[model samples]
Structure formats: C-alpha cells, structure tokens
Target chain A: MDKNLWRWIELNEYETPSVPTTMLAKRWWQKMLQTLRPSRVEVSTANSAEEEPKGVEFKFDEQPLLDSLNTLLDQQNQDDPRVTWLVLAPASPAWSVIRKWANQNGWQPVSMPQRDSLLTSSSVDELNIPSEPWVVDDLSHGFVRHPLGIRWLQNFLRKTLQTPQSPGLVICGSWLYYYLEKTHGGLNRQALTLRPFDTESMVTSRIAVSRAHAKRLVAVSEGHPGIAAAYRNAFAVAAEQTEIVLEMPQVPTAHGETSTFVIYALLLHGGLSTFLLGEVLNSIAPNLIEHSLNLLRSHGIVRYQDDQWSVTELGYPAAKQFLAQRDFNWTSC
Target chain B: MDTQKISDLFKTVDSNAALQVVTIILIAWLIVFLSQRLLPRLANLLHSKQRLYTLALIPLIRLVVVIVALVMLVPIFIEPTLKNMVAALGALGLAIGFAIKDYVSSLIAGVVAIHEMPYRPGDWVTIDGVYGEVTHIGLRTVELVTPDDTVVAMPHEKIWQHAVLNANNGGPSLMCVAEFFLTPESDGLVVKEALEQIALTSPYLQIHKPVVVTVNDEPWGTRYRLKAYPVDPRQQFKFITDLSLRGKQRLLDLKIEFAKVETAKVN
Candidate 1:
C-alpha cells in the first residue's frame, strides 16, 4: 500500500480540495437547464431508473487504513515515547477504524458510562480511566451535550492528561473535537487526522473517477473517506459509465429553530440516539424531535443505524454549510 | 416684492415637470422600499457580521435614495439662482420651524444616527424605556421589535436627550449573564467551578469568548454570576436560560441550596 494512502496530518492541516470554479459553473448551468427543461430531466430520470444499478456500493476495506495507521504509529512511537496520538475521524463511520485497530492490537478500550450514569455529578469523579496503553475508540461517546454529560469527559480528560500515565491513543470524531475545542479549549496535544482525498489519490480501477467527479467528491466530502466513498457510490450510474454526474446533496430546509438545533446537536456529538438527543434537547418535545429527525432523514440529511442517528456522509457537506449559514459554530472538516 | 417678481423666483408650474417630480419620488420610494424589504432577507441568509453590515445598509440606502431624489426634484420646483434658492429655503425653513420642528429635528437626527451608527438594524438597543432588536431605521423614527414581539417606533430625536444602550453595536458578540443566589452556607468555590462548567457545556455558548464565573457576597447570600457569550447575539436569551437551568440543576445535585429572598427584593 502507498505510504501516502492514509497519510496522517495534523487536524488543522487537513485540507479538502476546493470545488473548481468550472465545476461550480457547470453545476449551476445544469441546474438552470433542468429548471428550464423539466421534460428532459424527467426522461433522463426514467431512463436512469432502469439503467442505473440499485446501488453502487464503494466499500473500502478498513484493513488498509488500519495498516497504514499502524505504520505511522510505529514511526511516531519510535520518534517520541512521551507523545499522545489523537486520531480525529469524521462523524459518519463513527469509530470503526479505531475500534478495529484496538481489537487487533488487543489494546484496552475505555468503557463509556451509560447515559443515565452520566447524568449524575459524581459520575465525573467516579470515571475510571483504563490503566495504560488504552484506546478510546471515539471520544465523542464519552460525553453528551448536556451539563452533567460534559463533567465526565472533562474529568476523564484531566485524568488522562495530568496523571503520570503511559502515552495512549484516543480517537475522537472531528465534530466533537471542534465542539470541545470551543467549549473546553480542546486538547492541546499532537493530533493525527486522515488526509483528505484529492483527484490524484481518488482514481481507481473499478470506476475511473473523472477529474470533475474527484473534485466534486473531495469538495463535498472535505476529504473525508467515508463521505467520499458514499458520494462515489451514490453518483455512479454504472461501473462502465465514464462520466459520473456528481451533484451536491440538497440540504433539507430547516423551517424552524428545532430542526436547526437538532442538526447542530447531532453534528456536535457526532450523532446521538433518539433518547440521548431528547436528553440533550430536553426542552424540545420528543415528538418534535422525532418529527425533525424524520424530516431530515427523508431529505437524506441524516441516517439511523445501530440505534443512532448521524449526519449521512453525503449529507455532511450540505448540512455543514446549512448550519454555517445560520451562524452555527462548527469544527473544520 | 412685486407679485410678478416673486412669481419669477419659481419655475412655471408644468404638468410634465410635476409628472417628472412624481416619477422620481416614486422611483426613490420603490428603491427604498425594496431595500428595506430585501436587504433584511439577504442579511438573514448571511453570517453574523455580514448580516449586521447588510442590515445597516438599509438606512444608508434610504438616505442615498432620498438625497438623490431631492437633488433631482429641487431643480424642477425652484430656479437655480442663489437668490431664488435662499428665498425658497427661507420659506421652507419658516414652515418647518413652526409647523413640524420636532419632525425635522428627528429627520436630521436620523441622518446623524446613520453616520454615528449608534444603533443599526439587528442591534439590540434600548431607547427611553423600550428594549428590543432594532428592526428598521426610518427618516424620523427607529423601529424595534421587543422580546414580547411588540414593535415600538422611537423618534430619532431620542438620541439627543436620551442615552441609547446598544448591547451589540454591530458585532455578533454579546455577553449574557446567568445569576444564581446560593445560600451563604454553600461553598462559593465549588459553586463557581460548577457554574463555569455549566456555561462551558452549554450548546449555545460561543466557545471563542471567555466564560467567567464571578462569585460575590451579597446581603442575602452568595451571588454567582456565570457570564459567557453566545454564538449569536440573538441566542442570548436561550444561552442564559440554558446556563441558569443547568447551573441550578448542577447546584442542586451538589446538595447546595438557593437563597430565598423577599418578593420585594426579587422584584
């Protein structure tokens, strides 16, 4: 595997390729053309329905990424024993790579307290940090966006950093990292983030990612691999089709403040179970929360899996821009 | 002066000139109306700083359109001679001084307000006793929509005698304080730390700004002030509510008691 395949850069250093001006102009023209000629769009949609595959799933094996991570880890460990490795991952796939790496290495994974347990003030003091060489697959899981929720995370962080303990690796969702950076001044340590995929890195044999497609993918995903893969899969009509028309996912109109808060909360915590979401946004009605979630899901802004609802990889770009437009604080993707 | 000489000071009244003057006024009104309607909508789509800047342009745009229309219309009504201009202005001044002095004063003050930018649209301002978000800045009056959703139109002349309190002049940052009066028996240090944490964890908090938890000894008890900035100035209420609610809950969980004060003191 190419050493640069999963290059680990600082969180601030991660750069998603900007969508080319030509691509944006092309997209704008296409939208205008579609608006002017709806009949043609209808015809193409009907034809594409039969021609396009049910889904073009682009599932990259996390093993390569883990292997790449291992190479970097060994080099970094050799370079400095005192350094703590913080892996900031995108919110969509949660902590799959970190979990896989921890499992393979037989490293101790920190247990996240139950949501109810986190509700008590004593829970923070009671948090037991794993001895040494422990792995926190996703730091976002350690806390919710509630008052009682963050105490545990704060306590856990203080213990992990201040105590005389062996260096450990912690994986945190980028969104959570950003939120913590705002609220708690963030972790002042060396962090490694996956390099965003650009046109040069995105080309493959199965489906040749055209320059335009790659640019669009990189722009939309902000170089997040999972989001990029989702985009590649969603836009691919056929394996043989050379020209992949990549359109940005449309963000659902956040008609009310509830929807806005729901999306912001989901992103801030890297996604939440409905119950936890209700706990964070306790003032909002449960049905209203459900309504917002359902509405968002219908627009493909969010997805439900493993009893959790997270911003979909494809929807992350639009959702992020949507929130940013409304002056919501966000972490750099 | 003879009637004919007085008549000579003015341009002959013509239907075309009257029509032209009306057309110019109508065009100016349309431009001002559209800007007042459209700019706020555009500003709403923008982020905080840009939103305020865009909103502030509403009054400036209206001022420009009115000035241009006046410049164009003045020539249609009065001759270009300095004597004619002085005579026309003297008559206009006398009418304004006696009939609508306050209204003219407010109009002049409105221009001054635009230049000074004491309070622009989107700014949380207090004039006289009314506190609300400045929604519009008209020629004579500044409109504000209070938290109760009541629209109050304050004359711009208030800027002269009354102090205009602007929470956020043109920036998004606005400090919000959530106060907790705890029993004297409660540990100030512990409550302070808890209040700080509560503000830090609040979703509405603007993390860029500092969160300060100040503890003061009061006659009744210990007053803990959790001060922080919200991501948007408009979220100040929600931010304070979140801080107070969580601060109270956390304090309660800490086994601390809130100070019970008299109803008069509370008021």
Candidate 2:
C-alpha cells in the first residue's frame, strides 16, 4: 500500500516513517510533489468528490494541489529541507501517500533494507509490546482504559518519526488523542478530528479538542463547516480545493507542561542541589511534594531525581518524532 | 546323657544370670520411658531454651530412644552382636516398607518438601491453580488462606508431585488485562474519553497505575479494550465485575453498544 516509501530510502539515508493515521500528512506529501510538478495536479480532499455535482462532468480544485506540488518542487529545486507533506483520509493513510508523493518527485524511494524493519506490522507484533500492569486489568483502579495507551500511542508516534525522507507522521485514534497530548510534552503538532458522520454534538467535541489549546487542530469533516468556532482558528469555504497551511500549529501544551514543569523544577531545584533541598519539595504537607509531583508525573514526560523530575532523554526525541510523523488525531503535534 | 546332666546343673542360676536375657531389655525400656515423659516436664520446670525445639524434635527424639532400646535388647534377647542387630533391622525393612508403603512414600516426600520449600507458612502461593496465603505448616499437611478467607488444607504428598507457581517470587504484584468490545460505528473518540475518565476516577488505583487501551476493527464495531491496574489481586473478580458494570453503564448512556467478541480459529 505504501510502496513509494521505497523511493525515499534510496534518496536519503534517513528512514521514511511508516503508515501514519493522519490523512493530512500524506496529503501534504502529495501536495508537495504536485506543487513541484507545474503541469500535474494531485487529488484534493475537499474537491475529490465534491466537484462532481450531478455526476458526469466535474472540475477538480487544482490550486491547493498546485500549491503543494509547487512548494515541494521549489524546495527540491533549491535543496531545501526534504519537505514531504501528507494527509490522512479514508482513501489514504499518511505513509501510503508519502510513497506516492516521493515517487512522483522522481526521488528513488527507500525500500526495506532488511526483511525486518521494526515498523512492519510483523515487527510491531513481534515486539509484543510488553503489557503494562494497567493494560489488562486496573479494576483496582476505576478507570475504563488504562493510562498506558497514552504512552503506547506516544511511542508509536516516536517510531513513525524515524522514517527517511518521507515526513514522519502518525494517525492517532480519536479516543486517546487528547489524553496523549495532555500527558506527553505535546509540541508543535496539529490535532485532527477524523469525523465519521459530522454530527452536531461530535462537532462540538471536535471543536473543543481543536480549540482546547491555543494550537490549531485541523478538523477533517466530510462537508459541513462543522461548528466553526470550536477551532483555535477556523478555515472553511464552499470550495473545490482544500487549503491547509504547512505551518506547524501553535503549541498550547503549556497547561500540561506547566504542571509537569513544576515537578521538574522541584526535582532539579531540590534533589540536584544542596541548598534547595528540604526548602522545596520536602515531602511535607503544605509542602505536599507528593501532590505536586503527582501532577508532574501524570504526564509520561516527567522523570525523577531524589524528590524531583524532568523530561527524559526520550522527551526531545519524542518532540522531534512528533514533528516528523505529524499524523491526524485529537492532537497531531 | 550329657544334655540331661547339663539341665540339672543349670537349675541353680537366677533369672538375673539367665544369660542376662530379659533383665537388660526391661531396663532399656525403663530408660526410654523416663526420657519421653520425664524430660519434657523437666524442660518445662526449668524453662529451658530447648522448649522451642521440643515440638519440632519429638519424632526425632522418639526415634533415637527406640533405636537405643533396640540396641540394649539385642544383647539380652539373642546375644546378637551390634553388627548383627543392624543387619537384622535392614533385612526387616523390606517387609515394613511393604506393609506401610504409602506412609513410607509420604514420609520421603515430606523430607523432600522440607528441602524443596514449595511453600512455607506466611508465603502467598498458588498451587494447582488455587491461590491463597500460606497459614500453617504441618508434618503431613499445609494450610492456605483463600481470597474468600477460607482455609485450604493440602497434603505434603500433593506438593511433591504437582507444580506450584509463586506470584510474589518476582514481586507481589501481578499484571492483568481486561478487554471490552464495541461496534466499529461506536465513536472511539467517545470511548477513549470515557475510559480515561474512569481510570482516573477509579478508587482502587495503584501507586503506579498503568491503564491502557487498544482500538481494533471488529465485525460488530471497534474493539475498544481498556487495561488497568487493580489495588489488590484478591478482589480481581469484583474489579472485573465493577468495570463491566460501569463500562456497560457508560456506553449505555452514550448508547455505545457492546460487541459480541469471539476469536476466530484459523485452522
């Protein structure tokens, strides 16, 4: 399904991210190629089906497609950041489109170096992701899904980012989208509401996820403008082509990060230093170091010192991975 | 004629000198009696440190007394040498073992069990897939505490043959997974939201609670699985039941339907 990704490997030593749940990432990649080729216009999600008013004759929106193509080519012609774009849709998963876009760009896509790339479905299963204690039964805890899902999703995103040339992207399930964002040190990523039916209540919720933080969450609706005000910034038009800015969304993760930062601050300030100890994060009530630490630890981003914590070595890697594998979800970043 | 003359001549010897036949045997029996009944009382009167080992050492001490008694009896009964008595006892062992075969096997198993330590008093163990707390250790039997707080008595012989898995050997906590299925049409977005909320709100939350979920396509709908941690394993059944109830309720209110989940056999 994602054969073109092979071209990316030949073109770059870097890895091409595997299939991403996000439709935008693949579309962005395709757009980049179309933009490169002045004569060719790629499929636009907004116009692919909509342009066919009464069947028979239809006109595709070539502008956005044209823009993606031009941007990709201009970058390639001038040796800019490999700049692959993509999107997630029913027709395309991010990696599936990444390969197509890469092939069209005339770059030899990278293929599996060995029969055993970890991203392969076979590899993921083989890894047999160690089941967390919470993965099976936390009935001891009243929660429905274990919190480990957030961690796994984050790990999945990180893995996707390792792909060569092709932009790193991921498609997160809407169910775990927001929690993962809130818990991980979510960065300059976009959130996408993969709409099944575009209902009003669902639109409201989607709007909430989109606008919940200052970051721009792209809403992938079937047709309707869909609760326009719910997004951090709304872009809607009854048009044949869809226009998505390539710019990364603003990060509003400060809310989650701030709470997390408090733990890191206390730990570094207290445990790592002498004078700061006992003065701060002393584990005493009023001090309630545990309480503050709990908030910080809830996010997978935090790690511990004597009584302190900070982001892990894996943290920045996660952020970089998030950028590369920008898949659509409750939050794309 | 010689035999008749010897019988007449031997008539004057007292029973004490009657080859010292039964006199020494009676005295040995007397010594055993004093040790069994008298020594325990002496220990109690003196409040001796050996008092703790008394219950533990009774069978061993008794075995020693009988062995000593038999040694004394050999000289009196048959004028047998020390080596000859040992040989006689060894010869009789096959007959004794045949008479009480199961007992002999069980006694041997008990010795193995002491060395093997499949379980000991106070160790939480699961045997024959029966999990519980170990409460008592006896010569032939062991007691366990069930989740329902019932005492389970098991024979030492069973422990020797069957396998027992110890949960606490790695660490007391056991990781468990619970799964729920819903229609693919059921909004995964909604399901994930509800599950995370439930996990955070759960009272039985552990210190390092690791709740997780997976969404897979099923004929009925998306298989939304939630795996969470339980505070105490003993209450696993209740935790599952509660999760089922709340899960059903949460979905019912949202009108999320459950998928009749079953695995397909490829073969």
Q: What is the C-alpha RMSD of each candidate to the true structure, in Å?
A: 4.4, 27.1
lDDT (10s digit) by residue, model 1, range A1-333: 355666678877877677778766875565444333423312122122113334656666566678776876665442243434565645434257767776777767777777667876564646565555567776777788777787778887777676435446778777777777666666787777777667666664222256656656666676676777766666665435556665555544444467778888888777888888988887666888898787677666778889998877667776776776567776666
What's the TM-score of each model vs. the native?
Answer: 0.89, 0.29
Worst 10 residues of 1 chain B by lDDT: B41-50
lDDT tens readout by residue for model 1, B1-267? 578876878888799998998899999999999998889877765567878998989999999999999999889978888899888788789999899999999999999999999999999998998999998999999999998899999999999999999998889988999999988999878887778878776767777788998888889988888889988888888888888887888898889999998867654
lDDT scores in order = 0.75, 0.39
Report the Cα lDDT for residue B201, model 2. 35
* Docking model 2 quality class: incorrect
DockQ of 1: 0.40
